[model samples]
Target: MHRAPRKKRRWPKILGFTLLGVVILGILAVVFSVQLNNGLRSATGKDTPVDTAVKSQLVRGIEAKKTGDASHDALIDKAAETLQQTPMKTITEAAGNQQKAAELVSQTTGVPEASAQVVTQAIFNDSKFDGVRKAMANGDWVQVYQQGKTLSSDPDIQALTRLVQ
Candidate 1:
Protein backbone atom coordinates (compact mmCIF):
# COMPACT_ATOMS: atom_id res chain seq x y z
CA MET A 1 0.00 0.00 0.00
CA HIS A 2 1.21 3.54 -0.89
CA ARG A 3 1.72 5.91 2.00
CA ALA A 4 -0.05 9.26 1.90
CA PRO A 5 2.24 12.22 1.27
CA ARG A 6 2.67 14.67 4.20
CA LYS A 7 1.24 18.16 3.43
CA LYS A 8 3.69 21.10 3.68
CA ARG A 9 2.91 23.84 6.27
CA ARG A 10 5.08 26.60 4.75
CA TRP A 11 2.27 28.71 3.17
CA PRO A 12 1.32 30.48 6.43
CA LYS A 13 4.87 31.47 7.26
CA ILE A 14 5.52 32.76 3.72
CA LEU A 15 2.32 34.78 3.63
CA GLY A 16 3.01 36.37 7.03
CA PHE A 17 6.57 37.37 6.04
CA THR A 18 5.36 38.80 2.74
CA LEU A 19 2.71 40.88 4.47
CA LEU A 20 5.26 42.20 6.98
CA GLY A 21 7.63 43.24 4.20
CA VAL A 22 4.87 45.11 2.35
CA VAL A 23 3.84 47.02 5.47
CA ILE A 24 7.42 48.01 6.22
CA LEU A 25 7.90 49.22 2.64
CA GLY A 26 4.70 51.24 2.77
CA ILE A 27 5.78 52.93 6.01
CA LEU A 28 9.21 53.77 4.57
CA ALA A 29 7.64 55.31 1.47
CA VAL A 30 5.44 57.52 3.57
CA VAL A 31 8.38 58.71 5.64
CA PHE A 32 10.46 59.39 2.54
CA SER A 33 7.69 61.43 0.91
CA VAL A 34 7.24 63.54 4.02
CA GLN A 35 10.94 64.26 4.25
CA LEU A 36 11.04 65.17 0.57
CA ASN A 37 8.27 67.72 0.99
CA ASN A 38 10.04 69.30 3.94
CA GLY A 39 13.26 69.52 1.99
CA LEU A 40 11.48 71.19 -0.93
CA ARG A 41 9.98 73.81 1.34
CA SER A 42 13.34 74.52 2.90
CA ALA A 43 15.02 74.79 -0.47
CA THR A 44 12.37 77.22 -1.66
CA GLY A 45 12.96 79.42 1.38
CA LYS A 46 9.31 79.47 2.28
CA ASP A 47 8.63 80.35 5.92
CA THR A 48 12.07 79.18 6.93
CA PRO A 49 13.37 79.75 10.45
CA VAL A 50 16.44 81.58 9.17
CA ASP A 51 14.30 83.93 7.09
CA THR A 52 12.10 84.70 10.09
CA ALA A 53 15.12 85.47 12.26
CA VAL A 54 16.67 87.70 9.63
CA LYS A 55 13.42 89.57 9.09
CA SER A 56 13.10 90.15 12.83
CA GLN A 57 16.66 91.37 13.10
CA LEU A 58 16.08 93.73 10.19
CA VAL A 59 12.97 95.14 11.81
CA ARG A 60 14.70 95.63 15.14
CA GLY A 61 17.61 97.41 13.51
CA ILE A 62 15.23 99.71 11.67
CA GLU A 63 13.35 100.50 14.86
CA ALA A 64 16.61 101.20 16.65
CA LYS A 65 17.61 103.59 13.90
CA LYS A 66 14.29 105.37 14.22
CA THR A 67 15.05 105.85 17.91
CA GLY A 68 18.28 107.67 16.97
CA ASP A 69 20.48 105.01 18.46
CA ALA A 70 23.84 105.52 16.80
CA SER A 71 25.10 102.24 18.19
CA HIS A 72 22.57 100.33 16.15
CA ASP A 73 23.70 101.75 12.82
CA ALA A 74 26.25 98.99 12.46
CA LEU A 75 23.62 96.43 13.31
CA ILE A 76 21.28 97.88 10.71
CA ASP A 77 23.99 97.78 8.09
CA LYS A 78 24.79 94.18 8.93
CA ALA A 79 21.15 93.18 8.77
CA ALA A 80 20.70 94.89 5.42
CA GLU A 81 23.72 93.09 4.13
CA THR A 82 22.36 89.81 5.34
CA LEU A 83 19.03 90.40 3.62
CA GLN A 84 20.74 91.34 0.39
CA GLN A 85 22.64 88.09 0.53
CA THR A 86 19.56 85.94 1.03
CA PRO A 87 18.49 83.42 -1.62
CA MET A 88 16.04 85.76 -3.36
CA LYS A 89 18.14 85.62 -6.48
CA THR A 90 15.62 83.35 -8.11
CA ILE A 91 12.83 85.86 -7.67
CA THR A 92 15.01 88.69 -8.85
CA GLU A 93 16.30 86.78 -11.84
CA ALA A 94 12.81 85.89 -12.99
CA ALA A 95 12.29 89.54 -13.84
CA GLY A 96 12.92 88.86 -17.51
CA ASN A 97 10.09 86.32 -17.56
CA GLN A 98 6.98 88.26 -16.72
CA GLN A 99 4.70 85.36 -15.88
CA LYS A 100 7.36 83.47 -14.01
CA ALA A 101 8.50 86.56 -12.16
CA ALA A 102 4.98 87.46 -11.20
CA GLU A 103 4.28 83.96 -9.93
CA LEU A 104 7.49 83.91 -7.94
CA VAL A 105 6.82 87.33 -6.50
CA SER A 106 3.30 86.36 -5.59
CA GLN A 107 4.46 83.20 -3.89
CA THR A 108 7.31 84.85 -2.06
CA THR A 109 5.58 88.06 -0.97
CA GLY A 110 2.00 86.83 -0.71
CA VAL A 111 0.90 89.57 -3.06
CA PRO A 112 -0.60 89.62 -6.52
CA GLU A 113 1.88 89.80 -9.34
CA ALA A 114 0.95 93.37 -10.25
CA SER A 115 1.60 94.68 -6.75
CA ALA A 116 4.59 92.48 -6.26
CA GLN A 117 6.06 93.73 -9.51
CA VAL A 118 5.72 97.30 -8.37
CA VAL A 119 7.45 96.52 -5.10
CA THR A 120 10.15 94.60 -6.91
CA GLN A 121 10.67 97.48 -9.30
CA ALA A 122 11.00 99.92 -6.42
CA ILE A 123 13.49 97.72 -4.63
CA PHE A 124 15.62 97.11 -7.68
CA ASN A 125 15.45 100.61 -9.18
CA ASP A 126 18.82 102.08 -8.32
CA SER A 127 18.48 105.18 -10.46
CA LYS A 128 15.11 106.22 -9.08
CA PHE A 129 16.52 106.88 -5.61
CA ASP A 130 19.93 108.33 -6.20
CA GLY A 131 19.64 110.46 -3.11
CA VAL A 132 18.76 107.47 -1.00
CA ARG A 133 21.75 105.63 -2.34
CA LYS A 134 24.05 108.53 -1.59
CA ALA A 135 22.59 108.94 1.84
CA MET A 136 22.98 105.28 2.57
CA ALA A 137 26.60 105.38 1.45
CA ASN A 138 27.37 108.52 3.48
CA GLY A 139 25.01 108.01 6.40
CA ASP A 140 23.28 111.30 5.75
CA TRP A 141 19.82 112.70 6.47
CA VAL A 142 19.04 112.60 2.77
CA GLN A 143 18.41 108.89 3.19
CA VAL A 144 15.45 109.59 5.46
CA TYR A 145 13.81 112.03 3.09
CA GLN A 146 14.61 110.10 -0.07
CA GLN A 147 13.53 106.80 1.40
CA GLY A 148 10.27 108.31 2.58
CA LYS A 149 9.68 109.74 -0.86
CA THR A 150 10.60 106.55 -2.65
CA LEU A 151 9.26 103.74 -0.47
CA SER A 152 6.99 105.21 2.17
CA SER A 153 3.94 103.49 0.71
CA ASP A 154 5.48 100.05 1.11
CA PRO A 155 5.62 98.96 4.73
CA ASP A 156 8.37 96.48 4.12
CA ILE A 157 10.50 98.96 2.20
CA GLN A 158 9.70 101.63 4.75
CA ALA A 159 11.08 99.38 7.44
CA LEU A 160 14.20 98.80 5.40
CA THR A 161 14.55 102.50 4.66
CA ARG A 162 14.72 103.10 8.40
CA LEU A 163 18.05 101.31 8.34
CA VAL A 164 19.49 104.07 6.17
CA GLN A 165 17.79 106.86 8.02
Candidate 2:
Protein backbone atom coordinates (compact mmCIF):
# COMPACT_ATOMS: atom_id res chain seq x y z
CA MET A 1 0.00 0.00 0.00
CA HIS A 2 1.25 3.58 -0.79
CA ARG A 3 1.85 5.90 2.14
CA ALA A 4 -0.07 9.17 2.58
CA PRO A 5 1.82 12.49 2.23
CA ARG A 6 4.46 12.71 5.00
CA LYS A 7 4.34 15.45 7.67
CA LYS A 8 7.29 17.90 7.96
CA ARG A 9 9.98 16.74 10.40
CA ARG A 10 10.83 18.84 13.55
CA TRP A 11 14.51 19.22 12.52
CA PRO A 12 13.86 22.59 10.71
CA LYS A 13 12.12 24.01 13.82
CA ILE A 14 15.05 22.90 16.01
CA LEU A 15 17.55 24.42 13.57
CA GLY A 16 15.64 27.75 13.47
CA PHE A 17 15.53 27.98 17.27
CA THR A 18 19.28 27.32 17.49
CA LEU A 19 20.02 30.01 14.89
CA LEU A 20 17.86 32.52 16.81
CA GLY A 21 19.69 31.76 20.03
CA VAL A 22 23.10 32.29 18.32
CA VAL A 23 21.94 35.68 16.90
CA ILE A 24 20.78 36.82 20.35
CA LEU A 25 24.14 35.85 21.90
CA GLY A 26 26.00 37.75 19.15
CA ILE A 27 23.97 40.94 19.79
CA LEU A 28 24.62 40.71 23.52
CA ALA A 29 28.37 40.34 22.90
CA VAL A 30 28.45 43.47 20.73
CA VAL A 31 26.54 45.44 23.35
CA PHE A 32 28.91 44.25 26.12
CA SER A 33 31.97 45.23 24.07
CA VAL A 34 30.60 48.75 23.46
CA GLN A 35 29.91 49.22 27.20
CA LEU A 36 33.45 48.11 28.10
CA ASN A 37 34.98 50.56 25.63
CA ASN A 38 32.93 53.42 27.11
CA GLY A 39 33.95 52.50 30.65
CA LEU A 40 37.65 52.42 29.77
CA ARG A 41 37.50 55.74 27.97
CA SER A 42 35.81 57.44 30.96
CA ALA A 43 38.36 55.97 33.35
CA THR A 44 41.43 57.09 31.40
CA GLY A 45 40.50 60.19 29.44
CA LYS A 46 39.60 63.79 30.51
CA ASP A 47 40.89 63.30 34.08
CA THR A 48 44.02 65.43 33.77
CA PRO A 49 42.67 68.31 35.89
CA VAL A 50 41.61 66.09 38.78
CA ASP A 51 44.98 64.33 38.75
CA THR A 52 46.83 67.65 38.78
CA ALA A 53 44.75 68.98 41.65
CA VAL A 54 45.46 65.89 43.73
CA LYS A 55 49.19 66.11 42.97
CA SER A 56 49.29 69.78 43.91
CA GLN A 57 47.64 69.04 47.26
CA LEU A 58 50.15 66.30 47.96
CA VAL A 59 53.06 68.57 47.04
CA ARG A 60 51.73 71.30 49.31
CA GLY A 61 51.46 68.89 52.21
CA ILE A 62 55.04 67.71 51.66
CA GLU A 63 56.31 71.28 51.51
CA ALA A 64 54.51 72.16 54.71
CA LYS A 65 56.08 69.18 56.50
CA LYS A 66 59.55 70.11 55.26
CA THR A 67 59.21 73.70 56.38
CA GLY A 68 57.98 72.61 59.82
CA ASP A 69 60.86 70.14 60.16
CA ALA A 70 63.45 72.76 59.18
CA SER A 71 62.11 75.21 61.72
CA HIS A 72 62.09 72.57 64.45
CA ASP A 73 65.69 71.60 63.65
CA ALA A 74 66.81 75.21 63.76
CA LEU A 75 65.23 75.73 67.16
CA ILE A 76 66.81 72.54 68.47
CA ASP A 77 70.25 73.55 67.22
CA LYS A 78 69.94 76.95 68.88
CA ALA A 79 68.96 75.41 72.21
CA ALA A 80 71.80 72.90 72.02
CA GLU A 81 74.30 75.70 71.39
CA THR A 82 73.03 77.61 74.41
CA LEU A 83 73.27 74.55 76.65
CA GLN A 84 76.77 73.73 75.40
CA GLN A 85 78.07 77.24 76.16
CA THR A 86 76.93 77.07 79.78
CA PRO A 87 79.87 75.87 81.93
CA MET A 88 79.67 72.58 83.89
CA LYS A 89 81.64 73.46 87.06
CA THR A 90 78.71 73.73 89.52
CA ILE A 91 75.94 71.22 90.25
CA THR A 92 73.52 73.35 88.23
CA GLU A 93 76.08 73.58 85.45
CA ALA A 94 76.57 69.82 85.58
CA ALA A 95 72.83 69.33 85.42
CA GLY A 96 72.68 71.40 82.25
CA ASN A 97 75.63 69.42 80.91
CA GLN A 98 73.81 66.18 81.54
CA GLN A 99 70.90 67.58 79.64
CA LYS A 100 73.18 68.31 76.68
CA ALA A 101 74.65 64.82 76.88
CA ALA A 102 71.20 63.24 76.83
CA GLU A 103 70.32 65.43 73.92
CA LEU A 104 73.42 64.22 72.12
CA VAL A 105 72.44 60.62 72.77
CA SER A 106 68.91 61.27 71.53
CA GLN A 107 70.25 63.04 68.44
CA THR A 108 72.65 60.22 67.69
CA THR A 109 69.84 57.74 68.06
CA GLY A 110 66.82 59.55 66.60
CA VAL A 111 66.71 59.96 62.83
CA PRO A 112 66.79 63.76 62.96
CA GLU A 113 67.58 63.96 66.75
CA ALA A 114 65.32 65.92 69.06
CA SER A 115 68.43 67.53 70.53
CA ALA A 116 67.45 70.63 72.50
CA GLN A 117 64.50 69.05 74.30
CA VAL A 118 66.35 65.82 75.04
CA VAL A 119 69.37 67.71 76.40
CA THR A 120 67.21 69.86 78.69
CA GLN A 121 65.59 66.71 80.06
CA ALA A 122 68.94 65.02 80.69
CA ILE A 123 70.21 67.99 82.68
CA PHE A 124 66.93 68.19 84.58
CA ASN A 125 67.22 64.50 85.42
CA ASP A 126 70.72 64.96 86.82
CA SER A 127 71.49 64.13 90.54
CA LYS A 128 71.00 60.41 89.93
CA PHE A 129 74.78 59.95 89.83
CA ASP A 130 77.73 61.52 91.68
CA GLY A 131 81.02 61.99 89.86
CA VAL A 132 79.89 59.75 87.01
CA ARG A 133 76.79 61.87 86.46
CA LYS A 134 79.05 64.90 86.55
CA ALA A 135 81.32 63.33 83.97
CA MET A 136 78.43 62.56 81.64
CA ALA A 137 77.12 66.06 82.26
CA ASN A 138 80.49 67.40 81.17
CA GLY A 139 80.06 65.45 77.90
CA ASP A 140 82.63 62.83 78.94
CA TRP A 141 80.52 59.96 77.63
CA VAL A 142 83.56 57.90 76.69
CA GLN A 143 84.97 57.94 80.21
CA VAL A 144 81.64 57.69 82.01
CA TYR A 145 80.32 54.84 79.84
CA GLN A 146 83.69 53.16 79.97
CA GLN A 147 83.31 53.10 83.75
CA GLY A 148 79.72 51.90 83.21
CA LYS A 149 81.08 48.74 81.57
CA THR A 150 82.23 47.68 85.01
CA LEU A 151 78.66 48.03 86.26
CA SER A 152 77.24 46.27 83.21
CA SER A 153 77.52 42.87 84.90
CA ASP A 154 74.09 43.43 86.47
CA PRO A 155 71.13 41.19 85.61
CA ASP A 156 69.38 44.06 83.87
CA ILE A 157 72.21 44.40 81.41
CA GLN A 158 72.33 40.65 80.88
CA ALA A 159 68.61 40.50 80.33
CA LEU A 160 68.78 43.42 77.89
CA THR A 161 71.59 41.75 75.98
CA ARG A 162 69.65 38.51 75.67
CA LEU A 163 66.51 40.34 74.58
CA VAL A 164 68.35 42.23 71.87
CA GLN A 165 70.15 39.12 70.68
Best lDDT among the predictions, by candidate number:
1
TM-score of 1: 0.25
Maximum-TM-score candidate:
2
Q: After best superposition, candidate 1 residue 34: deviation in angstroms?
A: 2.9
Overlapping backbone residue pairs in candidate 2 total 2
In model 1, the runs with Cα more than 4 Å from the true position are 1-5, 35-103, 106-165
Give per-residue lDDT, candidate 1, residue 98.
45
How much is the lDDT of residue 103 in candidate 2?
A: 48
Q: Write the per-residue lDDT of candidate 1 for residues 1-165, one digit (tens) a residue.
A: 998999999999999999999999989866564344335545785634433454565566555554446666665665555455545334323543445655666775467778977865764464545455444323233343556466667677677766756
TM-score per prediction, in order, is: 0.25, 0.26
Pairs that clash in candidate 1: none
lDDT per residue for candidate 2 within 1-165, as digits (tens), equals: 999999989999999999999999989866564344334435675323423343344345434433346676565455444334333222223344555455455553453355656545643564434545654444344445564665456576578656743
Instruction: State the TM-score for model 2.
Output: 0.26
